[model samples]
Target: MISHMRRLLSLSTAMVMASTAIAAAEPSAELIAAAKAEGTLTTIALPHDWCGYGGVIEGFKAKYGLTINELNPDAGSGDEIEAIKANKDNKGDQAPDVIDVGLSFGPSAKADGLIQPYKVSTWDSIPDTAKDAEGYWYGDYYGVMAFEVNKDLVKESPKDWADLLKPEFANMVALAGDPRTANQAISGVFAAGLSGAGGDVAKSGEAGLAFFKELNAKGNFVPVIGKSAPLAQGTTPIILRWDYNALSDRDTLAGNPPVDVVIPETGVVAGVYVQAISAYAPHPNAAKLWMEYLYSDEGQLGWLKGYCHPIRFNDLAKNGKIPQDLLDKLPPAAAYEKAVFPTLEQQEAYKEVITKGWDTVVGANVQ
Candidate 1:
């Protein structure tokens, strides 16, 4: 009788879990109609070239007949937060309806009452570790840190963080953006710290900052934000950026300058970015619909085309939803088999360290 009761209880719990997932995922018909009526979504800090946002924006506009007003294509995570506070009361296109930011910023945004709760239709497909419990934010996609080199200017490709320090790479190294404000650059510092201090980002970010200080002093590091134009022009031949961005640049500039995308051997880091609805969204329903479309199978696959691994990658692969052509563009499965993801707490801790130390430690002026 006791065993039978235990089995019954287990089955009941499983059923409840499934029901909760379904409840969170299903949007009301009224909600869909209301979104279509609103027909616009304002966003900030989304660069079209980064993480396939160019295709995503075009696809979303075409699919729902909604106009997406994207502001500040080159802004950082910090800038997005500022925009939210600055335009909270403005009922205009300038006020953002949605935001996509580094995972570390999610908690702070929620705490500040800047973002609201809205679960996507594909909520269950996302990993529990990558989403807020109350649905305030959820990861969209991720990429690993990598060394992006312009082969035309760089005779030898850098295979690891250490290799970038060699004389051959002098005056060649640049970061995706400013570490103080940009998620990618902050993660780059963490990746370098892993190699500099033997995989200890929890307490050795200062060492990573020190490494950059040396890199700057040696004249190997350029004080410039990395972009495809700099790489193509040979101004910034080697960029330390996300793998997705590196791969995108390589494919985008196939023959002009020739690009080499290499995942660093020593300290590789995978960082996830999440999307959320603004608490003061002028087009709230449209914002919700936008999130739904992004998490849908179609949206995930669209991100895959740009080489970013969607948060639902494992789930999608298990369901056999990934297309072969897109899969062909990805690095070997082995390359990411042991990829490291620092916890949100860990990322927060490292952000504090980097933000506080960047000035006294490295301080490479990029004016």
Candidate 2:
């Protein structure tokens, strides 16, 4: 009789564990109905190819059948926060329901009351280091900086940050965004500085400014915000962006332009982009539902398809959720070995030095 009881107890424990897992993955029926009633979610600064957001967005729409009103596909991380701040009083089309921005912007956005807190179902799976205690924002994905070049446009593709300044690259090199407001562009400057400073992160901002100043003076730099289309067309032959974007661009170009995504030999800086809902979100339920979809296993894998390392990577890997083929497609593990992640303080400090000095020190207004 005791043996029978033990077996029943074991079966009950297994059932409870299975049910708990199911509960975490699926949203509450009430939340889903509420989101459906809202019928829309507004987002800002989400380029389709960046970080595999294109697929993720499609999956959400197909699942929930809600219209996602996309706003400003090319806007920067700072611009996303500004959108929330500017539309605080207005809850209609202009107000964004959600934002995906750089790591440094998370705390600032929360402190400024531009974002509200809502922990997703998979919140615990996210690393504590990458998320806020109050859940205002959490890391979505990360990638190291790299140069994406149109191989057909140039005889020889440069391999490092210094090579971009060579005369051969004259009128060819472009930053991914305006350093004044774009996190990617600002991080591009910081990465170049890291290369210039021989990896002293504290000195990266000043060193980056000097590097761009020279790139501009030598007529090598293209003063424009860059995108995959521009890179393929040779308008901007060389663009500094996250490795994931570069890889995705290469795939999208698909040998017509024959792109090369190269990780610099030095100054390998990795940046993390975070996700949050707006404090003044018009479709608050849909926004929360969107967050749920992003942090879910399916959403995480979508980002992986775009070549980004999702913030929930560790948890996914530990559970054997990641596919072998997906892992095989990424750049070699060795290339990422030297990647350095900057602290929030370091990024914040350098951001001030870079943004405040870009106009005066670099003297090139990137449109």
Choose the strongest candidate by TM-score. 2
**Over 4 Å off, model 1:** 1-27
The lDDT, on a scale of 0 to 1, for candidate 2 is 0.88
Model 2 per-residue lDDT at 216: 97
Candidate 2 local Cα displacement, residue 84, angstroms: 0.8
* C-alpha lDDT of all candidate models, in order: 0.83, 0.88
100-131 in candidate 1: lDDT tens per residue? 89999999999999999998877776777788
Model 2, position 249, has a per-residue lDDT of 88
TM-score of each: 0.92, 0.93
Error of 2 at 269 (Å): 0.5
Displacement of residue 267 (Cα, Å) in model 1 is 0.7
Q: Which predicted model would earn the best lDDT?
A: 2
